[model samples]
Target: MQKKLIDDSFSIVLGKQGLDLAKILDEKKYINEFIIAKKMNLTINQVRNFLYRLFEHGLVSNIRKKDKKKGWYTYFWKIEKINTLEFLDKEIKKRIYNLEHLLKSRETKRFYTCERCNIDYSEENALLNNFICHDCESVLVLKDNTKEINEIKKNIIYLKKELEEVEEEIKKNKDFLLKKREREIKKEKRLKKQAKEKLKKKKINEKKKIKKKTKKIKSIKRK
Candidate 1:
């Protein structure tokens, strides 16, 4: 389900071609651009173009490696799953907000449509035009907004449900990242503690050797 959302976001941003690229890109590791191009049966430039489009949206990231023999650099790309999901979630929320506003407008206002020309006018405009189609010279009938309102309401419900799912995915991703970070921090602290213990033991051993040397010198002086 998360993968579907990511793919949908790619399709929205870069169309079908971007969706194809997203399918091939890895989330865990960076893939060589040349390899991606070969697998996708596209040119290097085409692949780069698609990657750059994703990059602009912070959906994908890349690193460049310099080739010693060729004295040039090659780029590798990877998909940022968390960022992609977040971006999709934000866009979905915006769409939902717009849909809600439209639904409200449909329910509250009156609209008139010209049957012949298929033009829509708000109540004020229809009133100003005297409820007549200026272009077609036909009568402007009051549009039954009930149907339109119902459709808009349905769309709002669907978008809200989708947003809820996307939000759940985002929460999961964030929790996973937090736990991974905590483990890394614990590992680092353990390594530092071990190093400190080793240093403390070495210092104690050095002090013992110095005390033995001093005692021997004092005994020789007494002799």
Candidate 2:
């Protein structure tokens, strides 16, 4: 379900082709462009273009490495899952805000429409025009807000739910990253402690060897 949401979000940003790329790129690993191209049956340049588009939106990340023998660079790409999800979340919020504003306007304001001309006007505009259609010369009818209001309300509800899910996914990603970082830090500290102990042992062994050599030298002199 999370994968579907992520894919749907990517598709919204990158179009239908974005869904294919989403499947090809891994969030955990950077994949070679050539490999991605092969999997998608696209040219390397085409793959780069798609990845670059994603890069422009900060949805994807890339790393380039120079080939040792060829001296040319190869690009590897990966999806920024958290960034993508957050982007969708912001978009959803914006839409919901706009829809709520429209809903309020629909509820509070009066609107008229000319059935003949199929043009709508607010009460202010209808009064300005004497409540008549300028082109058709017919009296305007009061517009019904029920359908439009219900539709907007439904959209707002759906977006709010989607926003909640996206936020949940973002939190999960953050927690996973935090735990991974903690493990890496613990491993680094353990390695550093071992290195310090090994160095201390080496110094003590050197000191013992020097003391033994000094005793032998004194004994030789006495003999």
Candidate 3:
């Protein structure tokens, strides 16, 4: 499901030319940028352009590694899964807002259409055009709100459904991120505790050695 969302996300963002870039990034951590270029069969610069776009969006991250052989720094890249999900969620919410605005306008305002040309125009635009079809030279028809409104309303419903699913994915990704953070926190705590315990044992051993030496010295004095 996550991969599906990732794929869906890239497809949406890249339109007709992109694939599952998130999956490609996720499969290898800190992957060399050149490797991505090779796999995509795109020029290095093209891949860099796309990756930079994702970087600006905060959907991908990178680290630079100096090439031992070439004496130049090269970057490695990976997807920021949580950020990608959040980005998609934000986009969906924006669309939903636009849809709601359209729905309200459709419910409350007037619209006109050119029936013979099957062209749609806003009421203000139609009025500005003098309610005449520019192409057919026919008078504009007062659009019936019933059929088109129903279709728009249905589209709004579908968009809302998709928005909810995107929200759900965001929630799931957030939980995963939180859990990952917690695990790292716990691991650090555990390592710190072990270090403290080791120090405590060393102190105790040192104290024992001191007491044994004092006893031996006192015994030698008494003898």
Give per-residue CA lDDT, model 3, range 31-135, as digits (tens).
Answer: 988888888888889888888877887877899989899999888998777777777777777777887788789889888899999987789989999999989
TM-score of every model? 0.90, 0.88, 0.86
lDDT of 2: 0.91
What tens digits encode model 1's per-residue C-alpha lDDT throughout 114-163?
A: 99999999999999999998898788999998888888888888988888
Q: What is the C-alpha lDDT profile of model 2 across 116-197, one tens digit per residue?
A: 9899999999999999999998999999989999999999999898889999989999999999999999999999999999
Off by over 4 Å in 2: 38-45, 67-72, 116-118, 134-138
Task: Count the clashes in each prediction.
Answer: 0, 0, 0
> What are the RMSDs of all candidates, in order?
2.0, 2.3, 2.4
C-alpha lDDT values of all predictions = 0.92, 0.91, 0.80
In candidate 3, residue 48 scores what lDDT? 85
Q: Find the 10 residues in a row with the least total lDDT in model 2.
A: 1-10
- In angstroms, give how far residue 90 of model 2 lies from its true place: 1.1
Write down the lDDT that model 1 would get.
Answer: 0.92
Q: How close is candidate 2 to the true structure, as a TM-score?
A: 0.88
| Model 3 stretches astray by more than 4 angstroms | 124-130
Identify the superior model by TM-score, candidate 2 or candidate 3. Answer: 2
